[model samples]
Target: MTILLALDDTDSLESRGTGRLARAVADAIAKHYPIWGVTRHQLYVHPSIPYTSHNSCAVIHIDADGGEPLNTALSIAEKTMLDDFVEGSDPGLAGATLDQVAPAVIAFGRDAQQMVLTQERARTLAANLGIWLKGLGGTQDGVIGAMAGLGLAATRNDGRFLQKGTIRSLTGPTPAELLLGAGVDEIMTLDGRRVTEGTIILKEGKAAKACPINGRVVLFVDEQDGKLVAVKRN
Candidate 1:
């Protein structure tokens, strides 16, 4: 009955929003089930995202941006098939059915520039976890719902590098991989539409296109192939 809240970073909405939501869900579960512990992890897309842990009976992935956090949350809920209510039972007891209890909450966010979860992948996660679905709505109330959202009420950052041309690409490996290989950099995205050099001030994957700035530096480039790939900054 431990709840793991894996976040990308402390700066993003996943940290603030999903962190709050995890707290709320933990609160509700505490009332009926004995929560073992709640943990959070910052995630990155490079080196490939880690599969939800085996210890996690349920997981929630929240994108740094808006829409996907809710969508991912709902997908996890559905996969876990979390019950809204459980009969008087000790969740800590062996062989205890996780009735109305979400075993884990996998909250996602940004590490460098990579978006970790995808819509199709989220739906697949739900199928794997075996939980019900519910969106984590926007607002304080929605935050509360994200925590409590399992029942029904459950409503539910990083840096720069360089720019080349209209199609600027990192001249190395993927951001995350580059970090492992080299270190870090102050790489920024160049506006293709405006042709202005701008850094990513704010970002969210689901809302990437809608961001005021042009394309973000979610991936690096293969200096050889001239293709976008993951890279470490610096």
Candidate 2:
């Protein structure tokens, strides 16, 4: 089973973003479970939403064969967040097995992309779905995005990878085979051209930013100056 551990609103403007915190949490959990990837889920951006920057949430995808209880993973994530908790940040956390995510949860994620959502609604839906969700601080409004992040990630079609294998350690031009070995499932051009043998050139100092396509980590590239350059498509 695939497990989705989600976090949101864990940082104020003065502190690191939630995506970084999610990576820290993933690193802590990596001691026990195999991390599939860390994904950044974008939420609705509006005047009403009090976000540190782009109003995005983070999720750590895990393979459930680690033999650890769900609470163990949750406790690790919770401790990681609290260890670097920023004052005035409204942090929310949620976890659910891929199979337990219902249609309503996905709809809620879709809705969050276009409209405002409430904590009560998020909490109620999580309870009904048997998803573990909690607020760490402040308004606890993070519960909304935390649950939404899980729902979006459960779809296996939204968000970009904030952490995927050793993709972050690579820079400059890299072989397609190397990227695949580093947890990239497929390497293709933005126009759907699949590449298997050629090198995917990275733009200067940029690292590979992969997106989930059809439940696989797909790295999209575009031909620029006669070289295939990786594109950030979030």
Candidate 3:
């Protein structure tokens, strides 16, 4: 089962951010189900928005088998946000089974990136889709961005990984298969063209990013130092 667990707010300027808490949720659930790591989606950061800092939300993907229940993960997120979030933070948690997410909810994500969204609209869409939405403290305004984050992430071509598990730095031309084994989904150029799985492409001692592009976590590379070295997408 593929799940998108998104969170927003959940922090103060002087405290730990929501991304940390989102990873904590993924770590806790890893004991039972396999975690695909968490992707960070930058929400609308405008003068009209009241954000602690960078207005980014996170969605951790979990591919579960018949073994563990999904509630186990949601419980971890709820308790962690309630306990670890800074005082006065309005932490919102939104969860969706991607296969079941509606078109409206997905559209909500695109809207959020372009303009300010209301908590009321977010709640209505979550209710219609039967998504799990909750707020921990403060005004609960975070519910808007929380659901929006999940929606945007479901686009499958929107953001970069906020925290992928044990991503080691590359020293030279590692095999493309090796990079895929480390959680990358594709090898591509800046133009989104696929690169063949041969020794010609090397990692070249750079940090690789698993960008969500066309429903895949693609590794983008460019010509650096006369060789194609792996690069990250912003």
lDDT of each: 0.26, 0.88, 0.77
Q: lDDT score of model 1? A: 0.26
Q: What local lDDT score does residue 47 receive in model 3, on the 0 to 100 scale? A: 85
Q: By the lDDT metric, which is better: model 1 or model 3?
A: 3
Look at candidate 3 and tell me the lDDT of residue 126: 88
Indicate whether candidate 2 or candidate 3 has the larger TM-score.
2
Q: Write the per-residue lDDT of candidate 2 for residues 1-234, one digit (tens) a residue.
A: 888899996468876889889999999998988888999999999898888768999999998742355678899998888777788899999988888889999999999999998988998898887889999888888899999998899988998999998999888989888999988999888788998878888766767989998889999999998888898887
Residue 232 alpha-carbon offset, candidate 3, angstroms: 3.4
In model 1, the runs with Cα more than 4 Å from the true position are: 1-16, 45-115, 138-234
Task: Give the 10-residue window scoring lowest on summed lDDT in candidate 1.
Answer: 88-97
| Clashing residue pairs, backbone N/CA/C < 3 A, model 2 | none
* Residues 1-234, model 3: lDDT tens digits: 688788986467766887777878878878877887688887888888778777888888888632235677788888877778677788899887887577788788888888988889999888877788998788898898899888888888788876665554544667776776776777787766677665324455535666787766777888666666777565
Candidate that scores best on TM-score: 2
Alpha-carbon runs more than 4 Å astray in model 2 = 65-68
Considering every candidate listed, which one attains the maximal lDDT?
Answer: 2
